[model samples]
Target: MKLVLVRHGETASNVRMVLDSLPPGPPLTDLGHEQANVLADALADEPVVAVCASTAVRAQQTAAPVAARHGMAVRVVEGVQEIFCGDLEGRSDREAYGVFVKTASEWADGRLDLTLPGGENGRQVVDRCLAAIERITEGVTGGTVVLVSHGGAIRLAGQALAPNVTASLAAGGLLPNTGRVVLERDGAGWRCTAWSGVDIVVD
Candidate 1:
């Protein structure tokens, strides 16, 4: 099984730094739509058998075009939703930076027990995302499965497969808006095939 995990396109929350400020879900911005288009074009040729996305609006929007082009219905998966940010939702950057830094620091230091106020810890996200992947891979054998999700969820999914990569994956591992990373599973386990997004031009 090959899993292609993609982060949603840029959103108003992203540009305004209100991502952590807003609620858990928000629709994509105009630029986000453009990013989605590029991403859809990029994966148009891959033999995608299943398309799944987080219930969040941004993730759904990001997966729509690709699913449409592939003629596959998207299977909404709650497990891939962004890390629950709790009280930090909708707060300004200045107000949230300290919390983000703190959580990130703990993650970097290998303290998996630390959880953000009213939010999920890294380990929880990793476990759930891996479970979701396992479920998705059950029947499918060879074709790619595209998962549209948030940055944190993407990181968690990768970490589930490669626990030793926690620090590096948490250190902003180049998954820009609509970016993708591919992982392949053999008899042993999942292995990363590619990292980051590629430019796709559609005529």
Candidate 2:
């Protein structure tokens, strides 16, 4: 199975750099909508059979035009939402973002046991995201499936599921709005083929 995990488009919270992880979150800005349409156009040639999205309104909004282009509805699946910010929810200060980045770095460094302060652990985040993917791919035997999700969750899940996802790539930075992390799942395991448009070379 081929999975394309896409980060949701920009929102006011994204521009403000706030940790808005909860559901029904901010809608996309005009630029974000344009980005989504561009994303749809970009994938027009792919064998896209289904589209899925997290519960976030931004994600659903991003998936809408893509699914519409494919003549399908966006499947809102559970467990693929953004990394919960918990106590840091809605915070935009540097300190808050600093803590989030530190925790993300720890996860990328293989510290899956460490919990984000007042938030989920790396293991929890990865597990749920993987489960969501499994659910989305169930009964699907072929073509590409797009999972519209958040940056933090996609990074964690990609790092956890793909052996080709290097620590540097996993920890590098937040995926830009509508950015994609493409993976292929086979009998062996999952392997990342691309991250944010850069192809991943297997070691």
Clashes of each: 4, 0
How far off is residue 78 in model 1, in Å?
1.7
Clashing pairs in 1: 21-89, 21-90, 21-91, 22-90
Q: Candidate 1: which stretches are off by over 4 Å?
A: 21-24, 163-166, 198-203
Per-residue lDDT over 1-203 for candidate 2, one digit per residue giving the tens place of the 0 to 100 score = 79999999989998888899889898999999999999999888889989999999999999999999989999999999998888899999999989999899989999988876788888999999999998888887889999999999999999888887878889995699999999987565789989999888866
Candidate that would win on TM-score: 2
Show model 2 residue runs off by greater than 4 Å: none
lDDT of 1 by residue, 100-160 (tens): 6568556655676778788778788777888887787788888889999877678667756
